[model samples]
Target: MPKRIMFTMGDIACAEGAISAGCRYFGGYPITPATEIAEWMARRMPEVGGAYVQYEDEIASITSVIGASWTGTKAMTATSGPGVSLMMEAVGLAVMTETPLVLVNIMRGGPSTGQPTRGQQGDVMQAKWGSHGDYQIIALTPASVQEMFDETIRAFNLSERYRVPVFLLADETVGHMRERLVIPDEKDIKLEYRKLPTVDPSEYLPFKPDDDLVPPMALLGTKYQFYATGLTHDERGYPSDKEEVQIELITRLNNKILKNADKIVEVEEFMLDDAEIAVIAYGTPSRSAKRAIKDVRQEGIRAGLLRLKTVWPFPERHVVDLATKVKQIIVAEQNLGQIYYMVKAAASPTPVHLMTKPAGMPQLPQEIVQMIREVHSS
Candidate 1:
């Protein structure tokens, strides 16, 4: 259980984290900024008695991962922007069927292959709504290489616990950045495995949830013969078209995450004890927010940072509370105000300004401090 110091990229650390979390199946395709994850998984999976496959495309990659997940082992996949676009249908399939899996999206600049080498968080909103229809997702944004390692492991835990697809939304900057990461001994890492069915073969239901709205998932090879489909399904996993069944099916899908918002979302507040303005950021932009706060604090200004660790379920309550305390809020993001609009909606009555830089570069601390000054002036 000795701690080991290893200097590595965020993607490499993420692959290692998945391995540590007992992920036995990695089905992925190689893509820039995220290929290292797949490469590392290929090298390490077999050594640990796990399976790794380089699929034909992103679509096939995710499709295979979803199929592997039904076998009751932890499953994962990694890709960049375009790959995420290709996996949208697969995402919906996983959601509709309530299959648990972890997807790591190492974002690059994009509407369509925008910037391959540079890191831009243009997928913030897309991650939430990319898949058609209404379903809630649990997404974690890591601010550092260390968090990239830590959060990926947590992503699998959340995905398994909720029986839903979870995302580790890392930007290209973090994915490519190399830093010293602490590789804790395997025995020290607390990992979460999905809940399994306990009922007799005659009584098993694939979509039937326990009290937590997460069902006891049974492996495909088990004695029970279960069924799953993307169509509206009842507790028995059979397709149903009746209004009452449809209502129950969709509501449970949304409620499993929305109702458990308190348990599913996490946020970190820095130096907000008595702040007049706040900087709201996550992922790479939050790094600038941290530095900006330190700079402003020395100038006799009361500024703070509200960094979101779990972005989805969007931290509405915490954001509103901080807005109530502060006179104004600044949302700094690498893209053109993807999350800024969300902050404005939640922080009503309190002015929320957008500090957006879409050139695929990280926002500088000075720029954020200047934005804070503007908030003070207005």
Candidate 2:
């Protein structure tokens, strides 16, 4: 069989990927570096019998998605840093209700509306910690146009599989880049839908979980009179403020992702078998890290790369193991060390170093190479 490849922009690939993954509805307000995703969905969704609505604000945009998800439809939204800030409350709502949702944050520079057109990965921690209260989230970072398409599908699958909001945390660099992407046949795409209630709807408890800590979903118009709220809820989905109920609900939410971290998170290990130095990175910077790793190797440095495909759940075990094996680790990002402390904490005693560039553009391969040499010499 001949290999098939298509040339397209990353944002277009992402919107198409969502459609292919059965995303039937997308509700979002337009924002820079992310508006292309919304525009693509607007043009494409109707042809596929899906729905795309440009809401008045990011808050409503995300709220509408939560409502649509309850109808048993695969739904999503796209936004950047400021919009993500607007959606934080709804994000907490999704978590409290255990709603299966997907959000694409095409991150750009931001303290407050900073550099709308440029790329920056300042949201490295926000994607995981933005929502209030304690809960787990699945966030995938794509370093290339291909992974933007590929990981969007994976985001939907994992979102349904875990009944948590999954995120495709793409930076502006990858979101705007034009590249070749091999579109796989529909049959080749592995799709996982939300698990339905097996028993009669009368026997259903909306917040009740099966063995894996994931509750089966029943659509809104179904026979079940399903109820859910952002407030702390019981197994029956009615709001409960009891101390024990709070503990059980929150504990289960945290454990579902943490206990199953091995299954839910993925990281790439490149040329690290006998490497004395390791470079850890994700999102667009990982692209540069790959380049630096190759070039550093040419200069007789046994440097390896650990590219995070799944940024959340932290991949602590992988970092810890590599820490024990390597003499030093370099944490690189497009922001001023947002994820650097995470690496330092996880790679304790490995003397992790930080290389960060704030806004404007992604960290270049040459910049990373210089840092690698400095760390190697030190």
Candidate 3:
């Protein structure tokens, strides 16, 4: 296949990316900003020999994705804030089961149904803590329509490689924005599939992990008779009540991510070689910050931008390193300050300031430039 380039919106590009990544199953509910993802999947899945199901709600949507993944399908689901809220418990179930799946949260403003049409970064923290308990998650935040396409594919690959749920944390601003998207030839796009169990059915212990700490997933309808449940489980995937079982299970889940943070976390630094003030941002806000940094640079402010391409498993090392060299770090996002706290903690000893735009469009470039000047002067 040849490279295809076209203009498209972020949500639609994300759906196309999933299909390109070999996602054969999509189960999701329709919601503002993210509905295009499901709509695109519904129309395109049949053409590509895939399945698309619009569930009754987000809970059923996520539940169906988990079940489909167990069947050895590349399954995914997309929704906005309220829908994600409804799927929290099921999210926990996926984490506990170590299911490899993709979730696209096109974040809209919310504590409730705050603003369905508006975009916000309020869900940054929710993506990490919405589900109960201690488990690590892979989340990527895309700043533009092009990234929505590229990052969706990356999300699926990561989920499969790590045997964990991965999220594309987009927002209404990016999801609805139009831009040029380039689709590479299938042969050129890198893809990853979950490792399958090779042991005989009788010898199979479903959750038994390899040295990487990611277990070989057994297909649901296969000859394997391994059991799986939400309860704390051992290598055999059976529920366990013992303290050691809980510790072993939870610890491995955490270690799989913590141990590989360097490989999983990614960020983009712009014009920071000799920057005096560093601006850390992601998602829609990063777009504004980029333009703002350029504006400040023209004014001789020596500003730079640190854009997070992978939001969760927060890129602490990069932020900490930037903090040491820059005089001060300015954190910007669409939310009041969800990720700001993480940056402050990681970039401690060095001063960190925040520029927040709550439940609104991403802060404008002019506004951000003004903030840069304020931080630069003081």
For model 2, residues 20-101, the per-residue Cα lDDT tens digits are: 8899999999999999999999999999899999999999999999999999999999999999999989988988888899
Residue 66 miss distance in model 3 (angstroms): 0.5
The residue-by-residue lDDT of candidate 1 on 96-184, one tens digit each, is 98888999999999989889999998998889999999888888998888888889899999998898999999999889889989988
Poorest stretch of ten by lDDT in candidate 3? 219-228
Please give the range of 10 consecutive residues that has the lowest summed lDDT in model 2.
1-10
Query: What local lDDT does model 1 show for residue 127?
Result: 91
RMSD in angstroms, candidate 1? 1.1
Q: Per lDDT, what order, best first?
A: 3, 2, 1
Candidate models: Cα lDDT each:
0.90, 0.91, 0.92
Model 3 Cα shift for residue 189 (angstroms) = 0.3
- RMSD over all Cα atoms, model 2: 1.4
Off by over 4 Å in 3: none
My TM-score estimates for the predictions, one after another, are 0.98, 0.98, 0.99
